[model samples]
Target chain A: MRSFIKLASVALAGLFSAQSWALNIFACEPEWGSLAKELAPEATIYSATTAYQDPHYIEARPSLVAKARKADMLVCTGAEMEVGWLPVLLRQAGNPRIQADQPGHLMAAEQVERLEVLQKVTRSMGDVHAGGNPHVHLDPHRLLQIAEVLRDRLMVVDAENSHHYRQRFVDFAARWALAIEQWEQQAAPLKGLQYVAYHKNFSYFAEWLGLQRLATLEPKPGVPPSAKHVQKLHNLLEGQSVLAVLTTAAQPTKNAERLARKLNSPAVVLPFSPGAEGAEDLYSLFQISIDRLLAAR
Target chain B: MKNISVWMAASAAVAFSSVADAQNRGRISSTEFNPAISLILDAGLAIYDNDEDYEIAGFPLGGEAGVAEEGFAINEIELVGSADVDDKFYGKITLGIHQDEGETELDIEEAFFQTTALPHGFTVKGGKFFSELGYLNVHHKHAWDFADAPLVYRALLGRQFNDTGLQARWIAPTETFLEVGAEWARGDAFPTGGSPQDGRGSAVLFAHIGGDIGASNSWQLGVSHLQADDVVTELGGHSHGGGDAPDNEFLGDVTISGVDFVYKWAPNGNAKQRNLKIQAEYFVREMDGEFEFEDAANAESGDGNIVADQTGWYVQAVYQFVPRWRVGLRYDQLDSDNQFSNVSFTGFGSADDLIEESGWADEDVKPARSTIMFDYSNSEFSRLRLQYSTEDSRHPGEEKDQQIFLQYVYSLGSHGAHRF
Candidate 1:
């Protein structure tokens, strides 16, 4: 009986070592963090920022830098979406493995097509990206493409578990295809609906659902709307029947509330990304966002 | 004529290949190799109750302390360019334009190249750059909360000191943030005057450790030491508290040691809307050498072997209750002590009387200043500030100087985010 107990102890030790040896993954946003969780459930994961914060701007805190330093791979929505802070974090982290041009650095936007590509970029246009719109994760079809690319990246960075990662990708892709059909059917009523948005964050979602963006509350991207701009928006809304004024959970509600009150329309706040406001995963994120839009009507 | 034709043909071939290359890329972009450029402009108006000339007693002044001449002035226009030189290095250049004595002058504030990819988390930088000795020296004038610099900084290091140097830093592989750096610089500035060749003038060693306290607070602590040879203190032209002029010289080795601490609180780790920061630093300087005084009227000289120790410190706190508004308060103080031996007077006066008249006979002079500032930022690129101060920075005997300032700072183009 003593010999049998000794054998059991050795097996438990092996199991714990395998768990400890899992790769460390650092995701810049919650969307990528949820995807990494699905792809590599056994690996340790850290999400740098939550959904309720603007990913465009952030402080490179020391805790985040520590995560970046020890990470085997870095995943981000990089089309200059995080132009304000990511470069400084990467530089300060001083981690060569996840630097640009390396396989460990995977940018989801690079795997899919982009919209609003500007021919002449200028600051007067108010913070328009040179690499086009970076909020492509909302498009289910594009997310699948990004998932495939990320799966391949994980294989390249952690080849010891390439077989396990590949199988997970296959399962995730098959389930994601079925879910896209369901979401499209559910969101059929949103087509041709006109609405106002706080910013261009909902461009991909609107494009996928066939919704018409009549006007923006913000004067420009990343710029707050002045009183004159808001007044102009109110005048436009008076002439047309609008669905609602849409804002994200990450944004403050004061401007949208003012617009909604003037227009007598319902104000809708949707979860812009995963891991916030009951949108804990990719599937639930779309469900919650579509349901909120429908409920506003 | 034959050789000229041959050269022309070669040039024509070179131009043809370049055009072909451009066509192959399928674009006509002129800024492909251009670096990131930015410009910062600072303009301010100062109102002073007493316009008498002012200087910190027992300290040498070499930086901008004139405070805009008590009227509307164009403080500075700073232009910066930065880029990655290659996969392994980065380069930055800054030019500052200011009005001095009714003439506009341009100065290169910083020009440096730093390595990005080095083994063992090591990085090296070389060129003319601000010494990362204190909390505020690395930050520019536009980034300051108040319109004017702190009294301690103006007295201890002449507002800010930048030198041509080489620095090497290493980040330890640990959970916390730990960085250790050393610099070898040309000590041709105030507080440290020596040769620029072979790095014999000045050397510095510094270390900083930082970490987070849960999700709401973060803190950092730093200590530094700087040593230089053949230091000279020149304070002839600067008048302190309505005092007469005396040509004074201090000679010997100078050493300065400093300690700094910073603590920041941001509720739920979201600093965008609200936050509070407290920062403080203490500096002590020692000069072991001789003091020489010259009477300009009689051409008489007095000499004494003296050792001087000077200390200064400042504490400041800033709070942002809303996204676009902030308020800050700062207090600073300076103290000095001089011990004299082997005193000799070659002038037509007694040694004690000469020392007393020259402002070195006293044990030490302590002066302090307090300031309050409020600023409104419409965006990250621009800010307007109002500041008021009650200061007795020149001498302990003089009454405090009441001052007010209104300033504006604006930035245009691509400006990179600063480190915390």
Candidate 2:
């Protein structure tokens, strides 16, 4: 019986020797999923956050539990953004591979330049964030760093496939840089234009495209703008020059209409996500949002 | 054709904005477009014991069809739609359908325009709206954590619904905080009288301020007050109860007035992942009116002077040991006084208002209720919840009891943003 078991083990080992599987990645956000797909084309991959929904309100279900239990590497948007559900998921996945302080566990927010970091935070504030906005994927200059950071982690998991992962990383990096140049040139025409935004979420994109964020529509953080505030904005418009009003996928529209009409400005929705509003892919998400912004102006 | 012209106008505007160095600079052309609309339909039937008859919130539900399921009932079918007008504004509409064994009902829930634009980090919003009180209230049936509203809500809100309001929310430039200003409905209420009812309505003014306390934390605090005139149900027949029951068995003129405070908090972080959230509310009310007594010996009193205090709160805590599995526990309770002093009405023989002057049923009463839910979350969009609840009705003594509930929520939607 011992000899038979040994023979079976050897055969199984031999079967996997050629492909040499490196790692299986479970990503909470689509950006990390994209990076993993680039670095390890052969590995199993699952992304919890879709391009369409808000990343903060993911529902926890059973199949996801089964997936987490088996994940070899887990990547997420930390900095309190995914705090809403990721912690619960991790505790339930119960896999030692991606538990905190483990090699396979990661909070992508810690891997890049953070914006909107607050000095002090308190619960009295409606959903205040401390480590800055976790929506860092919007910055292409940082996308390379995200990919590089992901590559290092993948390397440790599948040391045998290090070279393969490295090669994949280089190819993707080249393509990404090429795309950057193309996007910059295409967007140059609309640079330096002033626009109004409803929620502050699009600041990162605005910076990248050189759009001037003249003003925000929110009268108070988390507070809906009042009729009085809208009128105040109209008054502010008399002196401030702006092309249009901008907002995201889920913005309530009453205030926007008043502002748009008051200033004789058009309203536009830029893809607030990489591809969430349905432009097909990350590339299209950018193209789509920009197209709408310019179009609405 | 109207939409096409609008699209054309938008394209012309974009070309005008980006003419800095384009070959088609200011050409009034070169725009790719897609205008899509989305609709969400929510409907449900509830099986519970309640008496809407002879009451503003409950009377309509009970008196209309006599409770479809032995107090079990079908409440509403609401279809809400939003079509994007441009970047920051969208048009909204809500259509509602109600059902009872005897009659089917229809009404409009909300119809208005919504926007997300303000001068300084403000998201200005205006529209006929439902108040954003609890998590469940904001979402319709399919999205609820459970099939029914918690008992505390029903007891306090009269009806577990609120519609008609305007608000302005601002996300500080720092992006970690929010402040809100809201105005209550000018004229609207549950059990809306199809015909203009005689009585002055009420309005509420609300102020809310809140934000994240830490890296992964968030909370909100709000205060509101309402100015209510009097709620009067004119008796069509001789009655002697809450509203002059048939043959004089009605009560009269209940003035509604209240002051309330709400607070919520959730602590979050990286090292010791203890996810905890808690919310609490307190309400004070005084009802001034007259009531008819069931027993002739019992006389009505003008100083029925009703004074009461009610409170509700919930505490939920969860810990994530690893990705994909989570266990959570939540406890909530509502304690209130159901019985007010009896009323005194003059001119006997029990006609409308006359008979109601004499008060008090066979039993003495005080009611208090509570519920606890233990939940297990498996992923971002699914969970199984085990819940236990208890309530004490008007009779208070034997009517108070407990119950156990189990439910599952499975949702399918695209990803959403994190901060707000």
Candidate 3:
């Protein structure tokens, strides 16, 4: 009977050995999930929030907590973007390796230069991120910098895979640079094109493409657009030759549709991150966004 | 030479002012060290058939049991401050203010420090905080779907189990969500009464296990045990004969065990637009000891050896049918069985003699209630809710009381996410 028990225990341990060899990664958003996948293809990646969901607000399901508990590394966009949900998950997971100040914790925003950083913060400012806009992944230049930081983080957490991660980082950086140049050439016609947006979701993207954002549907950040605000956009469109009304996949399209109809312009829907319809990977995400914008124009 | 000196003076002033401007920018950029703070405001208007004196049947009024009057009232105002104390610990403080008996009172709801760097997947917390006994005890009131506490929670734990205590918990290194914890409390809350002898009155042990069912559904199950010693409880009820206060005193130990289950479903693992959650908890309490009751009319005391057992359970289901709208329904029931024998009442009149003869009821009194709620939230920070409930406990001839409440909750600043 003792021999049978010993053999059974050995079989159980062998079954779990496969999982133990792979690095378990928990990414707070889809952008980080895609980056982690690119850097460590052998790792088991779990994305907490999808592309079609607002990353600002998400429910911390038990499964998410469970994932965080066993994660070897956690990659996320910090600077208060996940201030609402990530802290609770970390506390509940009780994993010492992935705590805030640990080597396994990597925040992308901290590694890049943030835009629209505010000096003083108050509720009257309407949910403004004090660390500036956390939408840094939309800019390919910032993504390169964040990629380097994430690669180093993975090396520190999983030393055995340092060479694999370093090689992946070098290869990804070279390809990303080449793709950025190609995108720049293709998007030359979109420069200085005036457009209206549902929110300030793609400030970095607009800044990179040199597109001019004339107005926003929401009069204030984090607030739904009112009729008066939409009407103001309509009045502005009457005088200016705007290209399109731009919106993200996660945002509701009611205001965009209404504004586009009033102006007879196409409402351009862009993928904010990876895992959208045609943007299943990081490379395809930018290609689909640019193609949609160009088709709308 | 004079022309060259004048040019150098102008350049020096320009450089000095530029340096001062850079210093100002540096001061404004240093906001990283401040703690995260948040404030939540909840107020509502209520209408009820009860005349501010009606109490839920089979519920102890030791805690805040009375509801607001038929008018506008401030439900609660919560202020929270949290930050990492160091590399090894994190601290949080929550202050709650609410209107009670026409007076506003402030309570230190939770002030605790927890370890962040404990090895072996362990966490240790100390200070005054809510105990993790049942699924709902660790959650704040604003997180509830309905505007009021569930009937079972009110009867069993007095809304929450806030105590100054020490807790140690462990998260198992499993793929599934598995955790076990234990707490030693001062027992200044309900089910244990106020501070007992030496102030050590309650010990709680709990465990939870959860996992996902495929990709869209997740579920969790938990069990908890609370052992309270030497509970001197004052039963707040009316006498059967003369309508006077019964003032029954109970001196014994109480043991409560509970099990809770929660199931959630979100299509494609995206709950931004739609989701459904069902949660239920069942608890059973047993007490054994002496029960002494005062006879008001004859001014005599009756003593008996009483053994009582009580059970209560609540089940609620909430569905987010659309992005910003949610509806929920909840039902709860409480039942009690009391057995008393060898009662002796000396120098007593008719009322005292009647109480001594028939002190125990053969059948248990079961009280049940149901509530329904609907709410609309424009964002994660604000919500408007409307709720209605029917008290189904018919106390012989009393008509059923119906309640209506319209509430609004808005939270500003930074707040942590709620537990599932």
Which 10 successive residues of model 3 chain B have the least lDDT summed?
B21-30
lDDT of 2 at B268: 21
Index of the highest-DockQ prediction: 3
TM-score of chain A of 1: 0.94
* Stretches of model 1 off by over 4 angstroms after superposition: A1-21, A226-229, B1-33, B196-198, B233-237, B240-248, B293-301, B345-364
Q: Cα deviation in Å at residue B122, candidate 2?
A: 4.9
Query: CA lDDT of A263 in candidate 2?
Result: 81
Candidate 3, residues B134-180, lDDT tens digits: the string is: 88889888888889877767766766778888999998878788889
For residues A170-251, could you state the per-residue lDDT of candidate 3 as single tens digits?
9999999999999999999999988888888888898999998888887777777877889987987776778889888777
- Assess the local accuracy of residue A294 in candidate 1 as a C-alpha lDDT between 0 and 100: 84
Cα misplacement distance, residue A96 of candidate 2 (Å): 45
Query: Candidate 2 on B20-77: residue-level lDDT in tens?
Result: 2222211111011122222333332323444323221111111121212323344455
How do the residues B261-320 of candidate 1 rate in per-residue lDDT, one tens digit apiece? 988887656676688989999999888888777766656677888787889999999998
| Ten residues in sequence with the least summed lDDT for candidate 1 chain B | B22-31
Question: How high is the lDDT of residue B262 in model 3?
Answer: 91
Q: In angstroms, how far off is B129's CA in candidate 3?
A: 1.9
Which residue window of length 10 is worst by lDDT in model 2 chain B? B25-34
Question: What's the candidate order when arranged by decreasing DockQ?
Answer: 3, 1, 2
